[model samples]
Target: MIRPSGRTDSRLLWPIAIHPFTGTVEVVFQHLKRSPPLDDEPLRRELMTKLNEIEGVDLAEAKLDLRPSFPVEVFAEHSEEICAVPEWFAHTVALAEARRMPDGDPGTY
Candidate 1:
């Protein structure tokens, strides 16, 4: 789910990944737009609270990942750099991708 942060105009993208074996969930928050520095903590707290409200869910045990949107300069610097993917981003992508594949093995993928 993607929503605008009420505290600011910035948008937040929440991607959820579920572990088939353990039934564990992973939530990632990616900032889609830049906002004032002062709003960071409050915004994060708000997001966390909202996430906790999900039913049949364990927010505490869920793996949480937060990251900023890629800077425009990265694209100008290099073609591949256009995507400023963090190290953890790959893990999240892999998990998401695996979830979509036929007979996807969540435990090993």
Candidate 2:
């Protein structure tokens, strides 16, 4: 499940992964070469604002990972990044689930 940032009509959502050891939060966003790219600066600001609103999120250590979106038809190897704090991850997932589309479907083109 993913939440809308209300930044645009784009269906993309950010999934944050926190590194406790490094004290950093990584915002994972898909970068599709065929499509118009997401504006990173504004996105960083928006996400930072929401994250900092959390009781103990540290704003200074947030990072961005703009990874390429893999083709579904083509088999590819991938691994998910891990989050350090379970409660924070749960809260983020819940927020995403709440704003997600019904029937667990991604938005249509």
Candidate 3:
């Protein structure tokens, strides 16, 4: 699981999951009370591009899915630490480490 920073609104959250078997990635955008009026296609595209740039991974073979959700807002206060490092950044690091392996086998992990 990865948490990304940059959400100013306390009600907004983004979570991403990557499936190793099918190479499919799911991105979820959670809004507490309201949903964004616009689609998050640009952000998703940027993430896809970055992931595809990793060695040993074919972007063409990777599938990306976006999901949006709205949940009731119950919190009285917001925390600054709610957002964490973006998943893509960690994925890139992992990919780099995998490439350093003898056979570049990501499955070894």
Please identify model 3 stretches exceeding 4 Å from their true place: 1-12, 18-38, 59-109
Backbone atom clashes (below 3 Å) for every candidate: 0, 0, 0
The deviation in Å at residue 31 for candidate 2 is 6.8
Residue pairs clashing in model 1 are none
1-109 per-residue lDDT for model 3 (tens digits) = 2123212221233444545565443444332112222124454556545444443323342334434211112111211211222544345334544554566554332
lDDT of 1 by residue, 17-88 (tens): 444565344444433223332124554444455444433333442323353222233234453422223223
Worst 10 residues of 1 by lDDT: 1-10
* lDDT string, candidate 2, 1-109, tens digits: 2124432233333345445565444545433222222244554455445544444444453243353122221111211112323334345434544454455444431
Among these predictions, the greatest TM-score belongs to: 2
Candidate ordering by lDDT (highest first): 2, 1, 3
Best lDDT goes to which candidate? Answer: 2
Sort all candidates by TM-score, best to worst.
Answer: 2, 3, 1
lDDT of every model, 2 decimals:
0.37, 0.38, 0.36
Each prediction's RMSD to truth? 17.8, 12.1, 17.3
Q: What TM-score number comes out for model 2?
A: 0.30
